[model samples]
Target: MSRKKTNIEKEIRALKKRLAKKQSRKRKVRIVARSVISKSKTVIFDPCAICGVREATTRDHVPPKAIFPQPRPTMITVPACSECNNGASDFDDLFKVYLSMQATGKSEIATRLFKERTVRTLQRNKSLLAKIKAESKSLLVENTEGESEEKLGVLWDSEAHDHVVERTIRGLYYHHSKKVLANDAELKVQWLKSIPEEIESILELLTEQVIGDDQVRYKYYIAPEDPRHSVWLFDFYGAHYTSGYTEPTDS
Candidate 1:
């Protein structure tokens, strides 16, 4: 009985050792695979990522600081020239309000932005309020009670949302892949209301990056051969989702 017990103990110890070695190998393999597939590289912004024409004099926050509440999250900024940075100021303000309104129900932070800053901005900027009221459309949408109610919804101008998102995509592309997207590379943008089946599948396979307590969530895939060919799924405040791609244009 003693002899048999000793043999079993030896076998058990050997099995554990083998298992540990196997797991270690698996871990290393996974690390190598992820590194190779993702091609995560350090970003350097000597020249502006936007225009690529002028030297980067300042850093511009991708989503803009106005989009967040007080004591904002660690800034996610990219290199930009004074011209690009200053030109985007008004657009950033407008984006904050529009984003807050659309994403009010998405998260607590979003709610705070809407109640805290958005309202104040509207109060101060009557022209902006007038513009919104002018562009809004009355539509019959089903409420929680399953009854159709006439509600007013803002019909966002393509320029209103596209410009900010375009800049964001460029910044993120440079951040992740360390590739500056040229001006010739045209961006295709789609603000997704209901995600398509095919796109949903693709999104699952991409690398995910979330910023500032779920303020901005990005799932992206960049081609290994050409970083310019990249696909992005951007979720803002959990309510708004945008799918965009930067592809090489004929130009």
Candidate 2:
């Protein structure tokens, strides 16, 4: 029975992976179009999704392909420029936060937060979740290896306890979120309330650390090539916000 259950879980994960890939293509196209429209003088400037850098020159996906492997809006992309986008590629920092949230079992919330249109809110959530994951991982790694015995400050026995470490980190986060959910009145009022606001707070703190300020300085525009797609222009501004990411910013 346990083996059967494991297989079923694996199959489900595979399906989700395929779905994410399909969505990634769509998101990429959408963002491309939006960039063109924004350049046509249709809209205004907004903060970059990942780094909070204003006057963004590109549209980069948040949660990165490395962490999630597929793209959805929340899982899809963010407003960034060439510099920040390149920086994000080297590290899956934001995606790690979402992973931590998932490992902690706020997986649903983590999924929803990234699908948002607003970069600030998305980053806020991503940063908080990342911090939570990092701390939880550290604590677990520490307690398990009996670090007190060694004079070394670092937890050396990480790989030896991979499953336990991962589970402990995720479980702790889930438990904390569950507690918050229990006490949150608004959450009870609204079915599951919105995780975006909570995530926003997380990103705000993270931005201060990574980007030096919580302010994003990018211009958002719709795609010019495809009118149906919604993409944001990083450096240039257009007249209107499109429904999709790939629409041109100049049109």
Top lDDT prediction, candidate number: 1
- Candidate 1 lDDT (Cα, 0 to 1): 0.70
Question: Against the true structure, candidate 2 has what lDDT?
Answer: 0.29
Checking candidate 1 for backbone clashes, the offending pairs are none
Tens-digit per-residue lDDT, 1-251, candidate 1: 47755554344333323323322111000000111113577444376766665667899888788899987999788888798789988888888888898888768899999999999999999998998999998889997899999977887655757778777877787778665675556666666664444345334556899889989888776755555556677788887776666555651
Cα lDDT, model 1, residue 153: 89
Candidate 2 residue lDDT tens string, 1-251: 47755554344334323323323222111121222245566554553433333345776543243333133223334446576567544244443333333332224433433343223434656765354445543322233466643221222222212222222212222222221111111100001111223223222211111101111112122112322222121110111111111222232
TM-score of 2: 0.22
Query: Which residue runs of candidate 1 sit more than 4 Å off their true CA positions?
Result: 1-45, 143-150
